[model samples]
Target: MNDQRPIVIIVFVFIISAVLLTKLFMIQVLDDSFLKRAERNAIQRVVDHPYRGLVYDRNGKLLVYNNPIFDLMIVPKEFQVKDTTRFLEIFGITKEHLIETYQAARKYSYVKPSTFIKQISTNEFARIQDFLIDYPGLFIMTRSVRSYPEPVAAHALGYIGEISGRQLERDSSGYYVQGDYVGLSGMERYYEDQMRGKKGVKYKMVNVRGVDKGPFKDGEYDTASVAGKNINSSIDMELQKYGEMLMKGKTGSVVAIEPKTGEILSMISAPFYDPNSLTGSDFGKSYTALNRLETKPLFNRPIMATYPPGSIFKIVQSLIGLQEGVLTPETTFACNRSLVACHNHPSPVNLFGAIRNSCNPYYHQAFRQIINQEVSSNTYKDTEIGLDIWREHVMKFGLGGTLGIDMPNEKGGDVPSSKYYDRFYGNGRWKYSTIYSLSIGQGELLVTPVQMANLAAIFANKGYYYTPHLIRAIDGDQSKIPQEYLTKHDVGVDAHHFDMVQDAMVQALFGTAQRALMKDIQIAGKTGTAQNPHGEDHSVFIAFAPKDNPKIAIAVYVENAGWGGRAAASMASLMIEKYLKDSVSRSDLEKYVIEGKFMN
Candidate 1:
């Protein structure tokens, strides 16, 4: 028994020695994870943020650029301050704030760095840079903030903000970290991949106090950051500024496009804050205040807001009526008030006269013909089939759907299908009479201002349009424009049908939209008064100038402005003249719209 026990002890000793030898082998050569972790403790890893791309207008005028800023970073494990009061005074922060920030950094990591104070201006950083060396754990990390040369096109340019937790979780590329900034909206959000650039990594030797000693291995392990590609937008800056100036003190939107290329010239939503207000250290406060306002200055109305097409839709109706063979140029209808409420106009008018006078009864009767084409024996079934067909035609005109602009969160205005109506009023339960409001573009039919502008472009081109876009080139390469933007979308209407519609639209300017007339440019336009249950009617207008070879096609809407010709027509006229002539001749009309006197 004594001999067996000695043998067992020998075996046990041998087993222990084998385990120790294996562990030493792993520590010495087999595994390097532990060694890498130890290196992290001795060296500091810094992220090299690339410069964001610059934004320029079509004519090579700079619109958006980056301004140098700094973030004060800290490592909680190495942080020490002898004079706490002096430190707070130097950074212009309260003692409580400093403690809170330190606690957050500690919670994030004991050795890794985190942002303590963000978006420090160049002047501020210059004043306190020398004092930063006194604090052992603190260092300056350079960053850039977006700057606008002028306060125009706030919604189009957008702003950047700290990455949210949800965005970080969704980030599949793993490029962004805790303190990274991301584009939140507008073009910034739409073109983030092109505008954010690529981030680089750098290694530096540091002491126990987390101070940057020097570049580790003389930058042998460092990667260079590539700056973002610059963008050349299609917007005409002068026209955009002029449009915004004319839209001040109003509550609505304006959208203008070049008819030949479908490039957006101007997109203005009134009651906008300066883009700078959303930049720098005061972003949170400014955004909060703007968000709480009743007017909703942050709302991108041109692409987001939806309204009934009103009488401007009559032009579309005329084109559809012509294409469907339901009505002809010589078709006449009585100015019958009993059919639908309409303003006083000539009775027994032809198609051209109906458009010129915006005759409600003419469209009401015309819509009935369109929706009761005897496709089914049952009256209800026939109306349903006809409405579905009508919807298909309307959608081709870029109505009731998103136009796919180079912007985010664009709301596709409702072009209610038969299915939509079936859900609302039940299948086979409703007929044309039940949804007659759509006859004059006032029912469930809705459209965004940008879509309205596109419709005008469609008219200017006679039958087709390109998808509207804000970006024309990237890094001076026009070939980089998306294929979809260059692709033409035909409305499927015959070219001859548009000639009659165009003539009617030109006649309309001589009638209801007399204020939109130009002396030498020869304008064609239509005005609308959309019914508003909340307040007064919304004034709306759609127009294109130089009726022969139109340059700019525009749409304007003025909320609670009552008459379309009073405000909307005048604004559209001014925008057209400003784009073609580079100046406006009608000072009285510009003052009338800008001063908010049109409502009175």
Candidate 2:
């Protein structure tokens, strides 16, 4: 019985030892995945943002660059604010700021690091570094902020700001987080991807003190950030600066373009605010001040503000008249001061003479003839082909639609069609006589400063123009304007018709804008004093010079500047001479435009 009892005890002890070993093996091997995940929770991954791209003018002048900025970051779980008062005094912040920052960090997650203070300048960074040792959980990180060197072109270059919540949900590659910056307007918004570089990640092993000890697993997962692509703008810095100077204290816009390439040399929208004002810490206050100003400095008048083309549009009417074969160069029409008289003189004026005199009656007659011919034509009797033809010709010139420029927020000026007329005056009731105002570029015919400038470009090129653009290239690649834009568009008129029209424009310079003419240069231009609904006439001028081999084409509009030849014409001529001849011919004219004050 004693031998049997010893054998039973041995067997029970062996079984108990075997069960303990099996359990130990399961914990070490089978549960390894769970333990590994727990370790990863303690180690956090952080993204490092790369520097934004630089912007340069056509002549290689730096428009925008980056400046180093310091940001104070906090890891809420590790933060121990010892002596809160002293910490506040050192950082030059209130206790509320610290509490708010801590709360934000906690909301993001106690394990994640968050920004507490951002955009500390170099001087502020120097002062903070001296006392950084006192703060354990807080650390300084280096980042880059945009810096405008020229301080002009604010609207064109645009501004960058923090991304909104809506942007994050839509683009969830983690491309943007809570505080990521994005372009808000102009070329910046149009080319965000090229300007914002890719973000890089580093898995860091941080200690309980929030100190980055080293990379987790020796940085096998770290990615290097790519720098953003640089942009080369088509804007000529000198010309842009000069144009802005000319537009000082005025509410207007001036757009200058190279006829052949369609590169915008200068685009000035008056009442402009300094771009540097919207950058850095004072942005909120500065933005409020600008918004409250009576003059809306933020408005981009070149592409956004639509106005009547005025007498400059008479050129289009004349071309259309000649193209439709309703009027010949020798066709004569008389003009008197009477509003009701169609022809008041026995002496007949040719096309060149009529344009030189700006005879409204001649265009009225020609437009009526065109309408009657189209409505009575054999192809489609009663089909209003003349109005359709006119609409087609205008649309071919890039009117009535967006110009597809690189800038954001361009408004397409309205160009009414035959259908629009039909809507206004029931079918077949409204004739060319009912809408005679169209002959003078009034009524519903609206165009922008950019469009007018492009009109001048088309005439200068003898019938075609490239798409006007501000940025010339991205990283040295030329623009992608279509070949059709470079090719001439026949306005259904003979080349000889252009010669007559060109002669008339030249005569206009000799007649009304004679005071603006230079001694050595020949400038072909047209002056327009468009009647305004709000107040006095709006002075406008469109010109291209040397006349023979046109170089710079420009359009200028001055609100309430009175006579087109006096204010807008003088300014346009001065700019043209300054660009082509590199100097002004009339010192009195220059002083008048520079000092002329108009009541807005």
Candidate 3:
């Protein structure tokens, strides 16, 4: 029994020694976590941020570029300020702010680095860089902020900001860190992946004073950052400047598009702030102030604000009426005020004259014929079926749905369908008489300014359009623009029908829209006065030039600006003349629009 016990003890000791030896081998050879931790004590990882992409206009004029800035980073465990008051004064930060920032960094990570002070300008960095070495654990990391040379196109260009928690969670690639800058809106947000480029890193050696001591291990672990690809936009900067000038002191938007390419020439939303105001260290304060304003300067009205089409919708009704065989160009309707309210015009006007005169009763009579096609014995059933078909045709014009423009937060204006009405008034409960308000572009029909511009393009192109887009090329490659923008979308109407409608739109300038006419150039246009329950009627206009081969199509809207012929048409005319002739001959019209006197 004593011999067996000695053998058992020896075996137990052998097993314990083997386990210790294996663990020691693993810690020394296979595992590098402990080694990395020790290395981190002397070597700091510095992020090399890439420069954001540059933006240029169609004319090759520089629009957006980057300016170098510095971020003061902090590693909490290594951070120490011997003179707290001096540190606070040097940074221009309150003591409370310093403590709060440090506490937040510690909560994030004790050993890892975080931004202590963000977006110090080059001049500011030069003034404060000498003092940074006085405090341990603080280092300067160079970064960039966007700079706009011109203050135009703020909404179209957008802005960049620090990565939000929500954005970080949604990032599947895991490319972004907490302090990383990301595109927040507009083109900046839409093309973020292409414009962000790749970030690189370097293992930088530093002493206890937090001063950089050259590359660690001769930069064996360093990577080179690739600069972001540049973007060439389709905007005509001169025209954009002109449109913004015309829209100044007004509460509206203007969107101009080239008819052949669907490239956006200019997009202007009034009451916009300078793009420079939203850059650099003051972005937070500037944004807060802008967001608090009642005018909402940040709102991208061209694609976001929705309005009724008013009389300009009569042109669509005329084309649809011709396609459905419900009315001919020669068909006449009496100027009856009993059907719906309309301004004084010729009685018993034909389709051409109805469009020229914007006769509301003509559309009211035509809408009834289109909706009551005798498809069903029951009048209500016939109306329901007819409305569904009519909606299908209207959607082809890019109404009641998003045009899929390369912008974020675009609102697809409402085009209430049979189901939309059924939810309110039950199925088969509403008839042609109940929904007659839609005949004149009122009721539930709504459209964005960009959509209205596209409608003008459709008329100019004689039945089809391309999706509107702001980007023309990426990094000098034109093919990089989305395929959808290059494709044609036909609106189902025959080309001949558009010709007749085009003639009537030309005549409209001599009829109700005389204010939009130019002496030297032949212009085709339609005016609208949308009913606004909150205020006066909203003035609206859509137009294209040269009568035969159109170059540009534009839509303008001015809130509470009385008649469309007075305010909206004038602005659109000036824009057209400026684009086509490269100069405007109508300074009188320009002065009238710029003075903001049309609201009276």
lDDT of each: 0.90, 0.79, 0.91
RMSD of each: 4.8, 3.8, 4.7
Q: What is the lDDT of residue 281 in candidate 2?
A: 62
Q: Rank the candidates by TM-score, best first.
A: 3, 1, 2
Candidate 2: segments with Cα more than 4 A from true spot: 1-44, 130-133, 172-174, 340-348, 377-385, 479-496, 583-585, 598-600
Cα lDDT over the full model 1:
0.90
Per-residue lDDT tens digits of candidate 3, residues 1-600?
Answer: 987998999999999999999998999899989888777888999899999999999999988999999999999999998888888888999998899999999999998999999999888889998998888899888999999888899999999999999999999999998999999999999999999999999898888888888999999999999999999999998998898888877888899999999999999998778999999999999999999999999999999999988888888888888998898988998989998888888799999998888899889999999888989999889999999999998999999999999999999998888898899999889999899999999999999999999999999999999999999999999989889999999999999998888998999988877878888889999999999999889999999988898999999999999888899999999899999999998878788888988866
User: Which has the better lDDT: candidate 1, or candidate 2?
Assistant: 1
Tell how far residue 572 is off in model 1, in angstroms: 0.8
TM-score for every candidate vs. truth? 0.93, 0.89, 0.94
Q: Is candidate 2 or candidate 3 better by TM-score?
A: 3
Runs of candidate 1 with Cα error greater than 4 angstroms are 1-42, 208-211
What CA RMSD would candidate 2 show? 3.8
- Candidate 1 local lDDT, residue 445: 88
What is the per-residue lDDT of model 2 for residues 372-474, given as tens digits with 9 covering 90 to 100?
Answer: 6745644232435677777787877778887877788999998888788778877777766666777777888888999999988877777777888877778
Candidates 1 and 2: which is better by TM-score? 1
The TM-score that candidate 2 achieves is 0.89
